[model samples]
Target: MPEETFVIAGASLAGAKAAETLREEGFAGRVLLVGDEIERPYERPPLSKGFLLDKEARDKAHVHEADWYDKHNVELRTGTSVASIDRAAHQVTLSTREPISYDRLLLATGASPRRLEVPGSKLQGIHYLRTMADSAALKQALAHGGRRVVVAGAGWIGLETAAAARSYGNEVTVIDPEPTPLHAAMGPELGGVFADLHREHGVILRLDDGVAGFWGAGQVSAVVTSGGAEVPADVVIVGIGVRPNTRLAEEAGLDVSDGVLVDQSLRTSDPDIFAAGDVANAYNPLLGRRIRVEHWANALNGGPAAARAMLGQDVVYDRIPYFFSDQYDLGMEMSGVAAPGEYDEVVYRGDRESREFIAFWLSGGRVVAGMNVNVWDVTGDVQALIRSDRPVDPARLADPKTPLAELA
Candidate 1:
């Protein structure tokens, strides 16, 4: 029998893990992991938190040791991108114009940071955090601090980077059009908590304002807001959001929506193709709807599920969405979906004023999502509550004496 080949594009956390899973599953066929960046696959969470803060070393962010891929007999192609996918030929053309044929293909192309289109965006001082290189550069820029840093967007990335900047003694100003920080993700109620957190830390908040343009001579000097105010900035970090890389799947004639559309098993519209991680808009049975999760947990687990599906296993990628963030002295873990309008009421457990609490988002009296801030050992309980899809008495959920295990 001819040796089967499996090709994984992106070499991201998801793609690299898929390769490892294939070898672990005893697939003796050829495995190729291709990526555009020169560095090997690494975890992204540290880029904004520990790595950016210089609390963690550069090598700590890597998914595996440099020699792991070679020892596992996996073909690692860094600094190489998939230029196009030929579905009929079952092959992908690389940026080097080399063609690699595969029996099964996994597209974990991941995402890129969104760039500002306003004037002076191309200035030298403007930065975006997505890759290891970006983090390293930002760290170097902020390490000596004392610079006027302006962060556009109060989303996760924006706020996290803002925290890092302020920690370095830089005068940080966070500007967002939303009424509060994390308004879209955590809703107005909980978003107010973060707004207060940053405010107490001396970070200026310019809420309900949008960046009209940037003004500077070769480097950004000030951000002009739509509200007709100019805020001086020696350094600018744009963290509006990210966009998934779905070109390869779309060009291959595979289904593509907000991302590559996949089934519960992570299989794409094409039977021979699969997708996971940030680029996959997969149907999650637990959520009863398709969700394209860009969080680290999804990529960490989704890759293995896709690999098993390729191995002819009955796989259902139905894990609840999870993500964590560390800003200032606050550490938080959030499970399930809490997007705006998805939940009716936000219930708090523990002390919100002390910044140590667990907040649950409820929909129709059932726990839809839960976030534990500066709290430990309750992630499982929080997840169980969301998974049980059972209604809980709001009073019991809020009572400090009532255990979360019982409420679920």
Candidate 2:
């Protein structure tokens, strides 16, 4: 059995965490961590905010120090991609034409940034915030400050980048097809709250708008909107969304839908193979539905869960989905799963206008999801309420005096 080797494709947050967990769980197996990025596995959350704003925060993005991987006996292979997965052979072929066999394999291939197919997208000075190199390039561009920055897509990354750009004193204009930024995720009401926050910080909002094409001589000089209006720009950032990297799994003939379909234990259709992180559309027992979350929290928690399952430990990843975002002076933490239009009513506590409040999405008097804006020490309570599945009184939920713990 070659002492049971565990091969992990993609040196992502999940993959790295799995490697760590394999050893922590008393699995004395050979671990091969492969990745396409040359850098060691690092936390991506800081790339858009801390690393971009402060020079000191650059190294803070690393998940672990350089020696830590070696100390843990993990063979870190960067700048290498997985060419294919051989399901029957229980092996994976690397881009370098090397074959690695595994008793258990993890596919934490994650996702790639959706590229803009519009004309002028190939032009220089246009960027997408995904990798360390991308962030470094954008940071250099924003360092001079006073550049005309047009951020297309009002999603979380777009909004965070716009906020960072504005902080650098760049003339920033954010565009999105929705009526308000984050309308789909936060709903129009709560989304409007963010819109106001950006406007208050001197950010120009071009809502219900999208980019038509780019217009520039060589470098990106302007963004042409669908309305035929040209917005001047020295730098343009596109943050539409990401698509899971499921080519290997699909080619391997594993079950694939929106992402790699996995059971509660994060096991793929093939017993020996597993998937986690942003690429796994895992079944959340708590929600009683299959959902894929592309957030820091999932990648952080899912990795260990998948590892434990691979080790034949009885585990179900039932952690309430959670994610937090920081933009300008506004900071928010959210837990539970509530898609757009899924909740019947939004019960608010504190002031929404002032941006210090907690908004709960209740379905039939039961809290499905909750978000705290500029509010701290309530995420645990909010998650508890959601997991308890108990109906909460609307009046008490909306009342700031009613402690979230009491509701839980």
Best of the candidates, lDDT: 1
- Model 2, poorest ten-residue lDDT window? 52-61
Query: In candidate 2, which residue pairs clash?
Result: none
Per-residue alpha-carbon lDDT of candidate 1 for residues 163-191, written as tens digits (9 for 90 to 100): 99999999999999999898878788999
Top TM-score: which candidate number? Answer: 1
lDDT of 1 at 340: 93
lDDT of 2: 0.91
Residue 318 miss distance in model 1 (angstroms): 0.6
Q: Quote the RMSD, in angstroms, for model 1.
A: 0.8
Clash statistics: count for each candidate: 0, 0
